[model samples]
Target: MGHAADSVTACLSKGLGASVGTIIAGSKSFIAKAKIPRKTLGSGMRQVGVLCAPALVALEENKAKILAEGLNKIKGLKVDTASVQTNIVYSDILKGSNITETHLCKILEAHGVLTMPKGPFKLRLVIHHQISESDVKYTVLHSESCNWVHW
Candidate 1:
């Protein structure tokens, strides 16, 4: 897991650097050619002390628990592990014709199990520390009872 994470991070860093370099080069060329003044560009920085402080603290405190909960959700769903890399998980419903993805979302929402519709027939579940194993079980059971065909 550590090795895979490291590889993903490395790839992301390389990709990010390449993208930033391209953006910077393009912006510089555009600025120089257009003679756009700095003030006109609105590229000013302000001190966001409060926002930065909490964000830093949240990253330090909540990252590990969030990752663990995500793994648990993936395991509970028993679907593609790759889709659980981040906090979001996507699942397809193959239930009855009238019970569309939107209908399923409405059902879950009415039961306080909020989810997002992905496509015409896809639903997205996001795992958070607040959601427990029992919650996952209840969600799955409810979905199954509704005769949702899993994809």
Candidate 2:
């Protein structure tokens, strides 16, 4: 049921919980061409199975939904919950609000929550295997109580 593409690259280090490595797949001719860069960079796939093992475990988890849903309830932020299918969550601060992504990130950081400012009004959050349910709850609770957003 997956859509077909000419070439695909999957980064195993981030969402997959792998320490390192990216898997690129394509036609034989495409791979043959890609090998030039791989060999030039001294990249090897030998013993990569050990790094790939954690992806199996990470695939079974969907902790981002728990965090996204909780964040959606905050008064000034809007989270498109349906679009969250992986470990990444993107939230937008509504226009006319007196808050920038950087400001929001600082408030979150002061409360021990770390988030990345994607744009003036957009913040990005990543949920990995290390993020627990309690961590999600604490983030949402603190975010709501921050009271930094003002239109």
Model 2, 1-151: lDDT tens digits are 2257878887776755767757777889988998888889998654656766766567556588888999898888899999997789999998876888998898999998999999879999998778888999999999988887653
For each candidate, C-alpha RMSD in Å? 9.9, 3.1
Q: What global local distance difference test value does model 2 have?
A: 0.83
For model 1, how does the per-residue alpha-carbon lDDT over 1-151 read when each residue is reduced to its tens digit? 4443312211211211221111112344554653356447864333446434543443343333333333234312324544455445676554344456687798778777788888766677765534555776676666655543432
Candidate 1, residue 111: CA error in Å? 1.8
- The list of candidate 2 runs beyond 4 A from truth reads 1-4, 28-41, 46-52
- Candidate with the greatest TM-score versus the true structure: 2
lDDT of 1 at 21: 14
Give per-residue lDDT, candidate 2, residue 144: 88
